[model samples]
Target: MAEAAALSRPAGVVGRRTWANGLFVLPFFLTFLALMVLPLGVGMWLSFQDYDMLGGYGGSVGFENFTRLWEDKIFLRSVLNTVYFVCLSTPAFVALGLFLAISLNDTYRRSAVLRSIFFGSSVLSVTIVTLIWRLVYMPERGLLAVSAGAVGLSSPSFMTTESLAMPGIAIVTVWWIIGLPMMLFLAALQQIPREVYEAAALDNASRWTTLTRITLPSIRRTIVLVAVIEVILQFQIFGQVHLITNGGPNNATRPIVMFIYEAGFRDWSLGYAAAASQVLFVLMLAASFFQIWIGRSKQED
Candidate 1:
């Protein structure tokens, strides 16, 4: 009976400890469920309902909202615009960011001032970045015009022109956000062992050879990470496009987010807006899964 009692005591104590641990985690779990999970669920619910009015949710319309997305011409154009911007911006962000990080990362020759000059624009608010670029992109009085005049070249207004507008926004976005990817790549560069470079130097490796064989291979994951992050970020571009072009000249720069905004707020098509948001959510999810697949594949290889 004593042995059975001893065993029972430990079981009781273990159960109490487990309960205490759960109690400690309960607040966090509840907060996450309330804040993140609840909103997501509500948004998903809202997407299916004809909830046009601000606080008035109507009956479920099933997949009507999703079906309309394919039929909506503006939404289709916005999706294409978003894809164009992503293609233009993602490579520039990844490549230029890596270049900046590598160039400024030399321990012997690195200058703080140079680093700050390159990275400073990134921390500025979106409005400030747009305003600054607006000045640079100004028709005749801007820096680009002034410089081009000095070089005997024509500087057209990129913001107003249909063909140039999206590309121009892409350039500004790269300047504004390149620092994030640069810093990320810089951190990854720092993690590469100094011994790797030293060994390459001992082997009489050229700069290009060392970079190709040693530097890039070592930070392959980081390059992939930066590319995926840039793709995700550029996909949701709204602020720069809105401020600079207002998706204008022909709605050429209108991104999916801007379309969703105009639908939800401007047109009062809440369900349609929510459906567009869901599509965006799905695209980002797909990109995330791709990143995971790449990581797993690299590990296996």
Candidate 2:
């Protein structure tokens, strides 16, 4: 009887633990369904039909939205712009972040301050960052223009010219977001065992060799994570352009997300917006899968 009672007590403890876990998990799960899963399912369905703010799905239009996107001029331009932004900004952030991370990993007093200054930028409200840069990018009285004039060079409109506008936006975005990956890489760098570096140094590995061989190889997972995250976030860039450029200077700064916003709100073309979003969604999914595949292959190697 005592053995049976002991078995029952173990089962009761297991049941209590399961209940506690479920209780702790329920809020997050419910929030995810409400905010993410449900909306995604609805958006996928809406992409197949004509959905507007005024009404629900306005009957099935088959692939008309998808088909129309292929022929959309603005949408095409937005796609190009987004591709350019991602290509240009992703590398800058990843490289700069990694460099700063490696440089700061040794942990001096100045390094702490520098890390705070760099990572502090990431915590700023995007609106505040956009507004500040908007002032800085001002053609005539802006700091950049004033600096250029001081240097005896002709000051050009950074935000007004097609050639320079997107690059200008890219620079601001990089400054704003580069810190996140930088901090991540810094943490990953700290996790590396001091013994590994010591051993490498004993073998006469140069600083460059140590970094490339020991530091990088150890932080491979973190690198992949930061790269994938930056790709996803920067690919959907909208707030900066919306505040600073508004996809202006001949739509040179128009990202895919900005395109969706303009179509839905500015153009009042909800169906077209939904269609464009579907395309962006597909592109993001493909990129994510490709990253995962590459990561898996690298692991195998």
Candidate 3:
């Protein structure tokens, strides 16, 4: 009877511990369900139905909204513009970030100050960044214009020209987002074993060879991560264009997210907007998978 009671006591303690662990994790699970899962499920449902704020939910239209999107010239244009922005901005962000990270890693004096200066812009709110750039890009009265005028040249309107609008936004995005990848690369660089570099030095390996073989391979994973993250972030770009250009210059700068926002709220086409969002989501997911596959293939090679 005494041995049986002792065994039962252990079981009770185990049960209590299991309960305590569940209790500790319960809030996070509940929050995730309420905030992420629930909204995503509802959004999926709304994409299939004819949902309008004023008209209320109507009969299911199946893929009618999606079909219309394919034929929508404006929507298609926005999609193309978004792709263009992602392509133009992502490479610049990743390359510049890696370059800066490598340079800073080699620097021994005031490295922290330089890192902070580069990363300080990223910590600012999106609204603040947009407003600050708005002033910087404003023609005649803006800093760029003022500097150009002092040199006996006029500054072209950065936000208004069709050719320059998207690139202008891309530049701002790169400046704003470069710090994250830089810091990520810096961390990855620090993790690399110094003995490998010492051996390379003993072998008299050229700088280019060392970079291509040693440094890059060591930080390949971090490079993939930064590239994937940049692609995802740039693909969904809207805030800067919305606040700065308002997708002007004949919608040349408009992106998919901005179009979806306009459709859902401004035009009151919730179902159509939801369909567009789902399409964007799918594109981003595909891009991410493709990048991961490419990275894995390179690693294997």
- Which prediction has the highest lDDT against the true structure? 3
Two-way TM-score contest, 2 vs 3, winner: 3
Give residue 43's lDDT in candidate 2 (0 to 100).
73
Show the lowest summed lDDT stretch of 10 residues, model 2: 49-58
- Rank the models by lDDT, top first: 3, 1, 2
TM-score of 1: 0.90
RMSD of each: 3.5, 2.8, 3.2
Residues 1-301, candidate 1: write the lDDT tens digits: 9878767786778798889989989999999999999988888988898987676777899999999998999999998898888889888988898898898897654455677788888889999999999999999889999999999999988988999999999999998878898889889999999999999899999999999888888888888888788878888899988898899879989999999999999989888899999998888788767876886687567
Clashing pairs in 3: none
Model 2 lDDT per residue over 1-301, tens place: 9878767776779789889989989999999999999988877777787877666557889899888888888889999999899888888988999999988877589999999899988999989999899889998799888998998987868789998888899999999978899989988988999999889879999988998788888888887888789889988999999899889989888889988887788766677787788889888778777776777688678
Clashes of 2: 0
TM-scores of all predicted structures: 0.90, 0.90, 0.91
lDDT of 3: 0.91
After superposition, the stretches of candidate 2 with alpha carbons farther than 4 Å from their true spots are 1-21, 54-57
Q: How accurate is candidate 1 locally (lDDT)?
A: 0.88
